[model samples]
Structures are given as C-alpha cells and as structure tokens.
Target chain A: MTSGITRRVRVLLWAARAGAADHSAVFTWKTWLFGWFVRMLAQVLFFATAGNLLGPGQARYLLVGNAVLMVALHGLFATASTTWELENGTLPLLVASPSSPSLVLTGRSLFWLPDGVACGLGAFLLLGPVVHLPIGLSAVALVTCLLVLVGLTTYALGLFLGSLVLTATDLRNVVSNAALVVMMALSGVEVPASAVGPVLGRIGAALPLTHGLLAIRRVLDGRGGGQVALLAAQEALVGACWLAAAVAVLTLRARRSRRDGAALFLT
Target chain B: MSLLAAAGRFQGQLVLTHRDYLIDLVRTPLLAAVFLLLVRHSGQPQLIAYGLVAPVLMAVWSMAMLISGEVVDSDRQLGTLELVIAAPVDFARLVVSRVWVTTTISLLTVVEVFAVSVLGFGITPEVDHPVVLVLGLLATAAATAGAAGLMAALFVATRTARTFQNTLSYPFLLLGGVFVPLDRLPAWTHPLGRLIYLSWSADLLRAALAPAPVAGAAWRICVILGLGLLAALVGRLVLGRVVRMVRETGTVGLR
Candidate 1:
C-alpha cells in the first residue's frame, strides 16, 4: 500500500509536468503574452470604462474585481484540458491506465495553480499603475496570499469539472463559459454581491472567490490582518472540500466505468 | 441539393450535434441577466436599454465570427476540405451562406434581450426613430456578416486559426463600442474603432434608440453599409486567392 501511494504520487507529478508542457507548446511567446497581458489589459480597460459611467468609485472596484477574476478564468480554462484528451483519442488510454483516475485528474490540473498565480500577479502588476490600486508592501503580501488561495480554490473546482468530462465530453465549453458568466455575476466581480438578489448572494457566499474578494477589498481599505486571515482560511477550507469532493466523484465514476465496460466508449 | 439547401442542412446538423451553437443561442439572455443584475440599482431606462442592446450586438458579432472562423477549420478536421474545394461551387458563397445562417440564428438574441429589459428590469427601450432603428439593425447584420467573411478568409490561411479566432473576441468588443461609447476610448483607439463597421453600427443604433434625435445618423448608416460592401468584396478576393494558393500547394486539409 505504501509503494502504491508512492507510485501514485510519482504519476501525479509526471502528469502535471506533461500537462504544463502541453499547455506551453500551444503558443509562442508573442501569442502567449498577447493572450495573457494584452487581452487582460483590454478587459480591465473595458470594465474600467464601463465602471466610470456607473460611478466614480466603481472603476477602482471593477479593476480589482476583474484582476482577481482573471485567476478564476485561468482555472476555468484549465478544466478544458480533458477535452484535449478526448480530441486526441487518448481518453480511453487514460481510463485504462492502472493509476487512479482521480489522482491523474488532480495532476492534470496541478499546473493551473501556478498558471493562475502568474495570471493573477500579472494582472495586478500591470494594472496597478494604470488603475492606481493601493499596492504597498503589506497590500502586496495580502494580495499574494489571496491570489494563492484563489488559485487553489479555482484549480480544485476545475478538477471537479474536469472529472465530469469523463461522462460528457462536449460539456467543456459550456461548463467553462457558464461558470465564468455565473461567477462574474454572483461573485461581486462586476458589482457587489449584496446588490444581487438574496438567493444569488447566498450562492456567492458558498463560492471560493467571494470571501477572497471581500478580503482583498478589506486589505485595500487598510483593515486589520485578522479579518484577512479568517477569510483566507475560509477560502482554503472551501478549496479543500472541493478537492475532496472531486476525488470522491472521480473514484466512484471510474470504478463504475470499469465494471460496466463503459470506460472506453465516448457515449 | 441547392447550395442554400445544403448550407441549411449543415446548420441543422450543427444545431443538433454541437452544443456550442445551442449555447451561443442562449448567450444573450445569460449576458443580459448578468448586466441587468449588475445595474439593477441604477433603474435608468436608457442605461437598461444600452445594457440590453449591447449583448444583442455582441451575440451577433460572436456568432458571426465564430461560424465564419471555424468553417475552414471544421472542414479540415472532418476531412472534407479537399472534397469541398474540388466541388464545382463558389467557396465564398458557401462561407457567406453559413455566416448568414449564423446571423439569422443570432438575431433571436435581439428578442431575448428586449424581453429581459422589459420583464426583468421593467424598462422598455425607446425606439423613437423606428425606420432608422430598423435600417440600423439591417446594416449592423450585414456589416457583421461581412466582417465574419473577412475573418473567415484570414482563418483559412492561418495554421493557428483557433487561437486567432479566440483573440478577436475582446478586441472587437472593446473597439466596437458594444458596451461603451467609442468616444470614451482613448483618442488613438477612436480611429481604429471607426475602421470597424460595428462602431458605426453602434453609433447608428444609439442615435436611433436615444430619446432625442442624434446627429450623424445618416453618415454612420452610410458608412456601415459601405464598409459591409467593402468587407464582402475584400473577403471574396482574399478567399479566392487563398483557395487558389492552397490548390497549387495541394495543402487543402493539411492544417
């Protein structure tokens, strides 16, 4: 059992490296930077311009919200990696592998943590001077922590959704796009969640980014560190729950697929 | 079957087989809900109208560009590009037909957005100039299809068609003034915005829908129609050249 655990760990790391390399191979440096930096700048500018029309304070709020939301977008897009396996006709091979499917799915999304962190950091650094975000050393440290938490939470959610791809291959874009729209709507990314209906507000509370966003706003407002720490812990707990749920769901589905001989078919 | 019938059948197949097209159909309502919920506190009829119309225009633009951009790649992927190219048909017509079908399907968003504005927000968009509004919608649809044709031409020759297709989404949204006025953008971007037909379309739309008569409505409409014609012409020329080049190189389905 110990050896088996070690082998799974090795497979997880190996799959992570392969996933990262596959992602990197899709773009040249120019395209990557253009997709990441330029596109992000455009999104920020668009929201900032729109926010300006709403109110004076809205631009700052939207700038920060969208910057943080970029981390979630990275995580959301990472969930589509399983669609690549389906497209390449390798999903069956993956299902047939002796390694645990849950671990493999977890590993496949492991790179999204660093990718989301980089995107979050890039959005912050690039937009800070332009949007005049309060970026002192303490704010930076707090935001960094927030970014890490947001990354882990979103990546865990991505792994959860990625496992669903095993059952429905065509759900990749629908899941990603719908998640983005819903998250942006409910998570106070564009507007305060409180302004939304009570039902959506409660839904936002359960989401990972909501507390992290509230904490980021507090940090910017020069609130005490205890609040930020509490929110960060809440966000981490949410992420851990999502990761555990994903593993459980994937294990159940994989076992059923193996028994029913449905693992090889696209259905 | 006639070319138009064939295209219709193809679109029907897409609707049945591909969930993306179905998602595209509902995108405007989803976006409308998001935008309306965000600005529900404002309770301004004009703001709600702007929010409603913006997503309708975005839906049109996205559907047009996606259908146009993916046609060549989809054909290649399905191993039918060479057969299609070898057939005695005008490739540009085929592409234009597909884009028109997409544009028609996307027009459903216009109704959905309007309904959201009325039912959800209790705001009815004022269309003071009904004639001008109708004319503007037609011009916008034509211009969008034309732009998609041009993008389709560009996608046919590029190896990284999907990346390029994805990259066009935000730039067009930002520059076209779908959600914000072009004047709000930087001075340098105004000229670039003017170059896109959607900017002119948006101008015409706002002028038609505003409570008071806005100036330059005629000029904007004219410019949009002219740009649509120019784009379709350029797309035809470019697509012809690219197809010929592909034929010469025998690389129709290579990408």
Candidate 2:
C-alpha cells in the first residue's frame, strides 16, 4: 500500500474497499432483502412455530432465541468471506506485501458487523409482537448495541476458522456451516446452556452467542444492570480470546510463508 | 434402469468430490440434532422417536429445495442448459436420477440420528412395524427424488430461482410439517401440508416407531409413490415447454 510504517492502515482501508466491492457483487439491495433477509425471517418463523409443540411459553422463548441468532449467522459469514481473498488469488500478493497479511484479513470482515446488527434488530422488531416480547424502547436500543458485540465476537471465531481455511480451502463451506450448526445447538439458541448439562454448558459459556443472548434476555426482562454488564463482559472476553487466536494463526502463517518463500498460501 | 443407475452413479461421484454438493452431507444431521435437542429440552423427551425421524425426512425435502431446487439454475448460469437439453440423454430422467442419489444420501440421516440418540441421549429408538418402516424409507426416498426433479423444472421457469432456493427452505419446511404433525399445525394448513410428500413420509415413519399397529400404511405408501410419479411426469412436460421458451426467445445459453 504505502511506505514503511503506515502500510498496515493503508492495506486495511484497501481491504474494506475490496470487501464492499465483494458485497455489492454478491447482493443488490433488493435481492439482499428478498434472499438473505427473508430467509432469516422464515428461519425464525419455523423455529417459533416448532415451539408450538412445547406450548406458547416455549414459542416465545424460541422466537427470542432464534431472532437473536440472526446476528451470529450473518457475522460468521466472515469465516467464509475470509477465504475469498485466497479464492480470488490476491492472498499471495498480500502475503508477499510488506504489511502483515493478518491486518488485511481482520479488517475486511468489518463490513458484516452492521448488517448482522440490523438482522438481529429487524427480527425482533418485526416478530416480537407475535412472541409478545415485553421489550421497551430503551431495551431495544441497548439490545441493538449488544448485538454489535455478538457480531464482533462471532466474526472473531469466524476469522480463526477462516485462517485455517487458508490451507484447507475446500472446507470453507463445510467449516462455516458446521460452525453455524454448533452455534445453533450449543449457543443457547435451541435450549438453555444449563439444560445441555455441565460439559456443554461450559462450551456455551465460552461460545459467542450464549452470553450476549443472556444479556439481551436480561434487558428484555428489565433486569438490573449488573447481570447485563457481567454477561456482556463475558462475551467481550470470549471474543478477545478468539480474536487473539486468529491473529496468532495468521501471524504464524505469514512467518512460515516468508521463511519458505510463500509456500503457505500457494495451496 | 441401467441408464438411471449410470446417471445416479456419476452424480454421486460429483457430490462426493465437489464441496458444493457435499456440504449437504453435514447439514442434514446437524438439523436432526437441533430437533433432538428441542425434543429433549421441551419436557417431551418421549417424543424422541418423532425427533429422530423428523430431520431425516426434512433432509430429503431440503435436498429437494437446496440442491435439486437449483440444478437447472446452476446449468443455466454456466451456459450449459441448451447443451444439456440437446444431448442424447433423457434430461428429465438424468435430473431425477441425480436428485434421487442426493436424497438417498440424505436418507443416511436415519443412521446418524439413530447413533446420536443412542449415544448422546442414551435413548434407543424403537420401531414397531419393521416392514412398514422399511417400505416407508424406500418410498420416501423415491418421492423426495421425484419432488426434487419437479422443483428443478419449476426453478428453471422462474428468473429468481437461485435466490428463491433460500426463501423456499423454512416456509416449505413448516408447511410440509416435516417436524410437527399436520394435526399439530394450524387447521387451514392441513390440506396444503398433505400435498407435500414429506407429510406422508413423516407420518409413515412416526407410525412405524409408535407402539401400535400402523393402519393404512399401504395406502399412505402408495400415495407417496403416486405423488412422486405425478411430479416426475409433470416435471418432464413442463420442462419441454421451458426448453422451447428458452430456444424461441434466443436466450437458451444466456439466461
């Protein structure tokens, strides 16, 4: 990008532009609404209706659980999109550049952040009445912010998975889809973490959506600040761990590529 | 029959080697796991039999919607639609065979769900009518393939087929009562739900697992087969018109 010091920042800006370009290529606004947004609505509707088997109370639980899952779903797409640079043949060029490749990879997925929040928020505001969520205006505002945290955290896990996909490119879809399934199962979307027993409960606690969801639930219940703050903090910590893992993996790959004259990404 | 077998063998190879087709392998069971989890957590673990069978049936329907739903659109995007039509092969049969293979793979969810239920939940699934269950499985697989073939024809008729695949997923899933029984669904949807082959398959499989004698199993099985045959026949006729429309409009290879 630029010269010696600020090259990282320059590459990040360039990566954002590239990500935006990719986004527009994939979706026109209308198709994005009809294609992606409508699917989210249908998915939430399916799960909420399935809750009818469990009665109305569980139906409400499912509506909230699945609607909040919209954020993690969109955000974890960063996992697949992270593999895009390599698929398009720009990955080698970035690896050969002076700026660290990790910088570019991390920054590009930022585009998914806001879209994810909107999905989470839209699902709630649209379907909440059917579930009859007792959400106040202030709570909606706060939950929107909490959804941003969920997006960032899930995207972090996605980036780590994406880094792994740099080598196993074919697993890109497999890995991302499997991860989505895991989030759906273990992330408090289907059943409470405690209900899944101790081992899975620990995993749900560590996963991205579990705490964020608890926080959202608390906000909707008009609970006090302490629970929300604690859960949010736990979510931020989980995200930080995943982000650190992603950075380490990327940095290691870059070092190995430099040592072997760019053999890592040649795959 | 040999032709169908050959076409199916070739398509199965592509599905194994290609990531696009193979991802369905993982997604089917994952969906089953979600159904099982819900069954357990919602205080009705006894309905584990329904939970186990539901996702397998749903997987067959999903294979129809997600894979067969886009078979034509995929060829259209690659400019292979006209070539595929002009070839010596029976295009409808080819599509049916390929989709049948995919739905067969989806049926493998039965094994996976059984393993998961036995292993994860310590609940061993029971089958009351072994003959009915076996016949139901074979019939369901056939009907799913036929449905997929029909979906392929319909998808090619519309411009938004690819995107429509995404939207088709859950709504059809809900309407078809893939998880819940049609009676459990709203009353108005019952007629429409009966039209889906999955509703029959789901009921058949659930009946086989229930502790009572399965009545009208033969009739239900026949209906599934009859619907499947009708779908395949209609798919062929509709596709003939689709080919003519594309050729006449001079957009055969373009869109």
Report the number of the highest-lDDT candidate. Answer: 2
| TM-scores of all predicted structures | 0.94, 0.91
Report DockQ per prediction, comma-separated: 0.58, 0.61
Q: Which candidate is the best by DockQ?
A: 2
Interface RMSD against the true structure, candidate 2: 1.8
Q: Candidate 2 residues A21-109, lDDT tens each?
A: 88888778998797788878878877887788865588888888998888898778888888888778888888887777898999887
lDDT tens per residue, model 1, B1-255: 489889867965775587766666656777888777756654444566567667888888888777756776677777888998999998889888877777777878888988878887677777888898888898888888888788788787665655756667777788988778898777999998988888877767777887787677778788998998899889888889999988898877664
lDDT of candidate 1 over A1-267, digit per residue (tens): 999889988999988887888878876777767765577667767777777766667778888888888888877775687556666776677779987867776787566677667767777787777667758887888788888888778777777777777556677777777777778888888888878889989988877788888888888888957988898888888888888977897788777778888885343
DockQ of 1: 0.58
In terms of TM-score, the best-performing candidate is: 1
